[model samples]
Target: MASAPPAGQGQQGAAAAASPLAPSEMYRNYNFLLRLDSTEVRFTECLGLGMRIEPIRYRESGVGNVVRALPGPVAYAEVVLRYGLATTPDLWNWLKRTAEGAVVRRNVTISQLDNDGATPRINWNLYGAWPCQWSGVPFDALGREAAIEELRLAFDRLDRA
Candidate 1:
């Protein structure tokens, strides 16, 4: 009395059921990894992955009441990465070299992983990135919170892949 499913529908359903993460499943933001060049670094938070275009307002000679906005230069936002304090000196060394007048740029990739943690669902690539600022972890003997360090990076371009 019931009509059969369309061709390949059963197979598709079986495949989806077998896979741990289906295409319709939304990726969790907390499951992500950061890579600077070839090295993988762990972080608690990543923010400010964005860009904006500055608009130039222009008025035609004959137009008196209308102002047109023209697209101008593009600006990429600085990305801030935070992690619990550790003995890793790579981040500190990079910031120190930059502050001492040596500029070293590297590509950074932030990938959103699936539930499996090994598969990357989304990737954001930052090109020609260099450390712009670093915040040292606050020390308090009475405090019961973990020490956290913050680093800000300035990049020339950002691409989502």
Candidate 2:
């Protein structure tokens, strides 16, 4: 009493299965790599590696309703990195030098990894990034969480490379 699938439906499914555009479970967020300057920064969490392009609007001289919008320069957001407090003195030393009026700026690279955590699927390159703020781990007598250190960086430019 059941009817067969429509013509080309099975072929369509097969084609989709063979196409690269088909969705897979390859992409994941847990596996990522972070590098600052030539040294790798170990972080348990990272965020705000993104940019937004502002739009320029052009209005007609005589017409009051029509407005054309054009793309403007892109603006990048600051990045924040969080890691477990440790004996790492390299990052702290660099930050201290910046606080001492050196204003050390370095390039950073964040790479999104595949499910295996080996292959890099995408990369975000940040230029002229300097640590603007650093936060020490909070101490509490009753808290059980691990001590966390946070660093906030401001970069002049960001690109996908």
lDDT of 1 by residue, 19-97 (tens): 9977759677799999999999999999999999999999988997999999999999999999998897889889999
Candidate no. 2 TM-score:
0.81
Best by TM-score: 1
Clashes of each: 0, 0
Off by over 4 Å in 2: 1-25
lDDT of 2 by residue, 72-128 (tens): 998988899999987869889889999999998999999998878888888999999
lDDT of 1 at 153: 98
The C-alpha lDDT values of all candidates are 0.92, 0.87
